[model samples]
Target: MPELTGWAWALLALAAVVVGLSKTAVPGAGTIAVAIFAAVLPARQSTGVLLLLLILADLFAVAMYRRHADWKALVRLAPAVVVGVLLGVVFLWFADDVWVKRTIGVILLGVIAITLLRRRLQAGAGADTGSHRIAAATYGSLGGFTTMVANAAGPVMSMYFLAARFEVKAFLGTAAWFFAIVNVFKVPFSIGLGIITVPGLLIDLVLAPLVIVAAFFGRWLADRMPQQLFEKLVIVFTIVGAVYLLVS
Candidate 1:
């Protein structure tokens, strides 16, 4: 591992907690860690290093929320997201992170805008009106592309669940499985792209423990909060994370 300054070390620990909590508990918080990686590491190595960390987080998310997945939704978004992953790889090759960051920021803000508009349009939606096939396709493509390029998956996917009015557990569970499967698939590609190095992996070893603790803590917190409050908290963080990405 490179000899990180103490401040960078603290940032890494904070990022680790964000990753675990996002995967296992809050569905939209990983954007902060994505920002952390982009800010702390080199432009190229950040994704590779963060990819490994994300996979670790995915494991914990799967273990905690495995039984509660929405398989049908997974099936619905799988093909599109796979296509997105492919496009993302190509995008990475051609686009500098200036474009990538701007692109994802636009996407995040767009989703948040859409979510707010949707709520205004349908003030009391208990469920979608089966008009969500196109919605699924849109979010899937954006989610896959943003995630692959920037590890910014949370907001894109969160928009989908929010619009569909998923109950809290269902939203979190589906998100857990979705990212777990997709992030694992990204491993070889990340390796091929020369993102993960032995040194970076070593750094991951130190941060991994924080991830585990945060996952458990997130679960504890989630179980204790009222459902409405949890949903509202998610919305607030999503807005914050999205805005931060746009600004940073």
Candidate 2:
């Protein structure tokens, strides 16, 4: 382990719980975890640790929502996502710690903006007239880049699924599968970039159980929490986290 203080461990545990919740219930809130991890650890090491935790949570999400995924959507996104991941790898190749931190902050703010836009558009009729092919390519590539760079692709992908007008379970299910596959695909690249390391793996072992428990808790909370309230809270926290990352 990296000899983090008690406070850092607490923050990491909280972020782990949030990751589990975002996986099973709140779709876009994982960005908050991204911010927390980034703020507490080195920018690059934070990405590696969070990626492993997310993959662990992904297993639970897939088990819970696997049957509901829309295979067509996954197929549509694969090619563009691959392109974006490659671009992200190139970016990581050249980016130093400060650049990675600033980029993540910018991406986090952009995610918030996208989520708000998604809500506003969802309130109106005929908000999805864009071609499905174009939409898929655009969102897939963006999602891939963000996920690779900062593990902050939830809101971007959420916007895409919402624009597609997926029902709740379908949205969660498709997202579950989408990330499960993508995150796995990212492992080798992350390793090649030297972000995924033994210290990060040690931290993941400590936090993995929290993710498992919280994922189940999220499933229970999903039905009870008011949607409007959930969205508002997530946006507020994400903004705070994003700003902290930018100026820290």
Candidate 3:
């Protein structure tokens, strides 16, 4: 089997928890998922397998929060995201395994910095923006590109939702449905790219059930937290995730 070592399995399990938590509570801390996979698997292969895990997590999230999603935002973001996916596929052709790892790290750090800056600005002031269409187009492209290349979609869309001032549940619910839909669509692309192999699938079989469990736990916690605190915690963890990537 194309299995990770014992330590790698442990890391993967922990990373799976991050995936669940991201969907249910944080909406952006999924670089842990990318980090664990890239650390254990070939960089390119990690992207494929992580995409599968993300889809599984996404399914659980959608099931738990289908009622909380904002369909208008989802529809607004889809077209630009599709274009970004194509761009990512093009980049994949040129990038090797190591470059993918470096690229993912760099992007994560940038996202972290931007998120912090956004938070600071919002605390003192706020950025002026023209229209929802503009934000949707920009975020959609970034989400599609990052998710395709590195399974890093969570942060991109997350920033948008945060800026939009969504209540906690709405943010998570919308993110849940959004990622679930995107992840499901990623399957054919991952297979066509030869990222998901027999051994990889076997490994995933072992890890997948844990995703379900964590999502349930995350849902319970998210339900309990007040909106203000949940978003604050999300920002804090996003900073932590960024730093982890930068140092790793």
Candidate 4:
């Protein structure tokens, strides 16, 4: 493990908690954790470390919301997502750390823009009624690529679910199962690429409890939050996290 200062440890711990919170409460909030982890550790290494924590949170989320998943949505997204993940792996194999960071930053900003545009359209008319293939190819590709590269798929997937007009529980349930399966899929790729390591696993072990605590806290908060408020918070946090990534 890299020797981290007390402050770094604290930041990472907070980021871990955010991962759990993001999974259970605010879907896009994981972007903040991504930015923090990337800031404190080497970009690729941070991605590796964060992945384990995300999966830990995913487990909690799946346990809570597994039955609510939209299996049709998952099936629609699977093929395109797989392609995107493979592309991301290819990119990771060749890209340096600076490129990785900048790419993530760019992806964050792009997702924010796309999400806002879709929301505006939804408000002006009705929800998007594009073909399922198009939606799957578009969002699923981006979601898979971003998650594979930066563990930053939360915003992309959130936008998709929102556009799909999923009710709160359905949204959480679909996202929970989607990421649980997706993150697990990424593990071998991450390991083969050396993004995941024994040291990263050790760090995750220390932070696991915090993730559990935050997951339940998030569940409580989500249960109480109004739908509109929940949506707004996700957008706001996504914007904040994107800006942090670009400027940091």
Candidate 5:
């Protein structure tokens, strides 16, 4: 394992708990974990390390919300997401750490803008139009790219599900399974790129239990949270995360 300082370890522990909560309670909150991990580790290495922790959280999310997923949404997103992942791999092939960090920051801000605009439009129209194929492709592709590059897909997909007008349970369920599969698919690519390493896995082993505990806590919290409060929290956290990425 890397010889992290006490403060670094503490931050990573917090990040792990945030990952669990994000998986089960507030989706966009995971971006905060991304920011924390990136601050403490090498940018690329952080992505690999975070991916493993995220998958662990995803498992708990799946266990809790497995039956609520929308298969139609998942099916529509698969192809576009795959394409986006391939593009992200290509970007990683040549971009340096600075580029990767800046690109992710930019993407986060852009996604937030688009999401906000879509919400306004939906309000005016009195309905969500996110069921269209083009909307799905756009969000899916962006979700894939951001997740591959920075493990920052939580906000992007959260926006999509919100725009699609999913109820709280359905949103969490779909996101849980979507990321569970997507994160698993990313493992080999990360390994091939020399991103996921033994030391990172060692770190994950120490933090895994925290993630599991937080997942259950998140599930309990989500069950009681009002839908309006939940959506507001997602947007708020996403904006905070985007700003942190840009300035940090």
Candidate 6:
């Protein structure tokens, strides 16, 4: 384990809780957890650590929302996601820690931009009806790449679900399954990259309970929270996280 201060551990615990919350309630909000982990650990190491935590959270999400998943959508996106993940692995092979951090920062900003653009287009077009195949391929590839690179694919996937006009529960359910499967798929690759270390695994074990507790809490909050307010807060926090990553 990298020698971290008490404050860094505290922040990581909070981020772990956020990871669970994002998995269950706010779709794209987990990017904040990604940002915090990256800021506190080496960017590459952070991806591995966050990936395990996310997989832990994913179990709860899948259990809570598994019945609501749209299997057809998952099937549609699978091939493209694989392609993007392979591309991300290639990118990771050559990029050093500094490049990884900067790339993550850039990706965060791009996610935010893509999210905003999605909302605007949705408001104008109202529930995408043009091309499901095209939409699935585009978003799937982007989601795979972002998740692989920085664990920042929540917003990208959220946009895709929104475009598909998924109901709230369905969106959550689909997202839960999407990440559960995808995160597990990435494990071998992450291991191959030598980023998933014993120290990181130890840290995940220590923080696992918080993630579990937060997952339950988020499930309770899922239906009750005001969507517009939650989304706005997520966007603000995401921007702050992106800036910090860029400048730090």
- In lDDT terms, which candidate is top? 5
Pairs of residues clashing in candidate 4: none
Per-model TM-score, in order, reads 0.94, 0.87, 0.88, 0.93, 0.95, 0.88
The C-alpha stretches of model 6 lying farther than 4 A from their native spots are 104-130, 230-245
User: Candidate 4's residue-wise lDDT over 122-235, tens digit each?
Assistant: 675664446556878888998898889889888888878877778888999999999999999999999999999888888888889999999999989878888998888877
lDDT of 5 by residue, 116-156 (tens): 88777768565544446877899999899988988988888
**Model 2, C-alpha of 65: deviation from truth (Å):** 0.8
In the predicted model 3, the residue pairs found to clash are none
**Candidate that beats the other on lDDT, 1 or 4, i.e. the better one:** 4
Clashing pairs in 1: none
| Model 2 segments more than 4 A misplaced | 104-130, 226-245
Q: How accurate is candidate 4 locally (lDDT)?
A: 0.87
Order the candidate numbers by lDDT, best to worst: 5, 4, 2, 6, 1, 3
Please give the CA lDDT of all the candidate structures.
0.82, 0.84, 0.78, 0.87, 0.90, 0.84
> lDDT tens string, model 6, 124-170?
56544446787788889978987887787787787678666677788
Instruction: Per model, state how many residue pairs clash.
Output: 0, 0, 0, 0, 0, 0
Of 4 and 5, the candidate ahead on lDDT is 5
Model 1 misplaced stretches (Cα beyond 4 Å) = 125-130
RMSD of 1: 1.6
Ranking by TM-score: 5, 1, 4, 3, 6, 2
lDDT of 1 by residue, 211-239 (tens): 88998888777677777776776777777
